[model samples]
Every structure is written in C-alpha cells, then in structure tokens.
Target: MSKYVIGDIHGGFKALLQVLKKVAIENEDQLIFLGDYVDGWSESPQVIDFLIDLNKKYNCIFLRGNHDALLCDYLKNGNYTEEWFIHGGKSTLDAYKTLDSVTITQHIQFLENLKDYHLDNFNRLFIHAGFTNIKGIEFEYFKPLFYWDRTLWELALAFDNNLKVSDNNYPNRLKLYNEIYIGHTPVTRINKTIPVNKACIWNLDTGAAFSGPLTIMNIDTKEFWQSDPLPQLYPNENGRN
Candidate 1:
C-alpha cells in the first residue's frame, strides 16, 4: 500500500489526470492532495467533481488551502474578496453552468471536512501551507497552519512559545515529527529546487498551476515522480506562480 503525496491541483484536472496515468497509480494506492484543489485553471467546477468521484473510488486525503478557504467563504457568505477572484476564482465560476442550492451546500460541506494537516502513515505529515511560530494548541491551529508564510516557517522553527530573553533563529533545533509535506507555494519550475525542506517540513508545491509539472512523491521508497510540464497561463515567463 504505497501512499503518494500530490502537489497543488488548482483546477488543472487534465494535468492531474496525466500525472496519475504517468504514475500508473493503482486502486489500492493512497493519495493525499496538498491543497488548492480549485481555482486558477479554467476547470474549477470539473476539478471538484472529479475529485469527489475519485474519493468514492480511491483513498484520497484532501486538505484545505487558502484558495479553498476563499471559495468556502464565498459560498457561505455569498460574497468573497477581490483577491480570491483575481487569484483564479473567476475561471472556477465559469466551470459550472448552474449549481442548485443543494449542490452548493454539499460542496461547501465537503471542503469543510478537509483538514489543515494530515499525518501520513502516522509518520509523514501533510499540510496545505505551513504552520505558525507558536507551539501547543496554536501550532495545530488550521488557519495559520494552512496559510503560513516564509517568515512564519522561519519563526515556527525558531521559537518555542515562551521566548527566553535570548533566542536566535535556530531552524535545526526544532522538530517533533519525521517529515511534513506541503503545497501552496509554486516551486519556480519542474523539479526545481528539489523538495524545500527545513528539518522536518517539506514543501511539495510543484507549480502545476503555473504550467509546471505535477509531482508525486512515494513515501515508502523516498523517491519522486513527475508529470510532463503542463501549460502555464502566467505571462511573466517566471517559473514560479
């Protein structure tokens, strides 16, 4: 029973399917999606439907990314900020011709169940984004844990709740798990920079939304697999999106 941790699939269903095919994934295999399941690409609605179907057929663990959070807010509150729409929510709305009230409610419920962190094989942890600098209950909090920035990751590894009057940014000094895998930050290019790791934390966002490869890392063998480079919509020509 091999478990594959996938990178962000932000409405790039075609690229995701191609990557799964390339991996020759089996029914028994378990897959954990890091997050950003919708938005960015032109097929947000279809991507969500496909993922729902996949859940019925295979073992899949879905986590909540920042984009997913925005969609949830829009559906529940009837309005979301311009930032979400600008960051690929428009294409997501374009996917559905007309979703009934029941459908809308169900989709939001599904998204709500997604966790901010998942411990694979009870050893490997998966999160949409990074964790906060605080420990104890705050470290496990979903919002900050799923949307942390570089500064947070650095701080998370630096301080332990109560700061001693004298403390420095000691990344290597902090760790409580074997490995933590995450997505949300595009990796500049296909297989670019390898896996971003800070001791136990591992960043696996392979930039699929930016037309980069969809990555699948095998936990048992400590090996990696990738799909062909997908098309990018960004005009800057920069690798990371």
Candidate 2:
C-alpha cells in the first residue's frame, strides 16, 4: 500500500477529484491531506462534504489548516474579520449558503476534529503549516503554531544545504523528523508549481488557491500528480488571486 500526501485544496473540488483520478488510489493506500480544504474556490462547502464522505471509504488523515481554523471559528461563533473574508473566506461563506444547518454542523464537527499535525512510524511529520518548538512538536507550547507558523519553512529555505544533521549549527527543529511534509506556504510563491524539497522539509502546496494546479505526491516514491489550474477548472471564478 502506498502513502500519498495531498497539498492545499483551497475548495477546488474538481481539482481534488482530478488529481485523485490521476493517482487511481486503492483501498489500501493511505491519503494524508495537508488541509486548507475550504476557501479560495467556490466549492468550499462541497469540498468539506466530499472529504467527510471520502474518509468513510478510505484511509484518510486530515490535518487542520489556518484557514480551516478560521472557518471553524466563524461557523461556531459567526465572527469574521475583514482579513479572513478577503483571504478566500468570502467564497467559502458563499458556498455554504445552500447547505442546511444540519450539514453545516456536521462540517463544523469535521473541521473541529482535524488534526494539528501527524507523525508517522517512519518519523515523517505532516502538518498544514509549521511548528516551532526547538525540542519538537510535542514540546510546542503554542498549539496554533502547528498550523499557523511559517518560521520552520523559512528556516528550511534559508538553511545551508551543506549543513548536516550532525553539524553543531544545524537547526534543532529540522533534526526532529526524518522528513517534514507541509502545505501552508505554497511553492508557487518561489515560482515552483511542484512539490519542493529543502533540507528535510517538503512543501506540497502548489497554489491551487491561486494560479497553480492541485498536487498529490506519494511519500515513498516522490511520484506526484497535478490537475489543471483552478481557474481552468472553474472558468468564471477568480479563486483567491
């Protein structure tokens, strides 16, 4: 059985389905999603519904994202900020307009139950964003950092490639895992539309919320698949651009 990690979907249900079709996933395969399943596109609520159903039939691990957290808070308390609304939240709100209260509550439960981070048997770490404890994720005092921090990725990007884990100056956080898989910061920002490896950190968010395609990668083989850009999938919408 293979283990696949998906990047930020950003409410592109069509893009998510397209990539999954490319993967031709099997029942034995594990699907680990890096969250941001909602927001950006016009089908945010549908994306959540699909994920809820998908998990019942497949091995799926859904992690919490900053957007997901914000959405959850909005759903639970009906509170929203101008920043949240502009950052794809408005689209998500529009998508949920047709859903009944029962379905909305179910979606809220799904969002509330999402994991902050997942550590696998092989010492691979999967998180929506990054964590900051110098010791490790478990030692992280601020739980929100698991899905809100960017310093870890920033550190990886700036790290000297020559620095080994055994080196005295190596970042302690990078040494905590054999590999770190994250999706909050899209690689498209660096002009890359594919999964990027820097040090031991791998960024899988290929900017589905913007101009790039949705992506999925096999953790073991590093084999990946991508769908057409979100704009191409939803011809009329601007997504989060």
TM-scores of all predicted structures? 0.80, 0.98
**Superposition TM-score, candidate 1 onto the true structure:** 0.80
Q: Cα lDDT of all candidates, in order?
A: 0.69, 0.94
Residues 170-212 of candidate 2 have per-residue lDDT tens digits of 9999888999999999888899999999989999999999999
Candidate 1 local lDDT, 1-241, one digit each (tens): 8888888878777767777777767899898888888887776666777888899999999888888888888778767667776777777665543777777777888888887778655766677777654452235544655654454445444445564424564443245456777777775633463455545566777777776767778866767777666564333322224
Estimate the overall C-alpha local distance difference test score of candidate 2. 0.94
Specify the highest-lDDT model's number. 2
The true-versus-predicted C-alpha distance at residue 241 of model 1, in Å, is 6.3
Candidate 1 error regions (>4 Å)? 134-142, 152-169, 189-194, 232-241
Model 2: how far residue 3 lies from native, Å = 0.4
TM-score of 2: 0.98
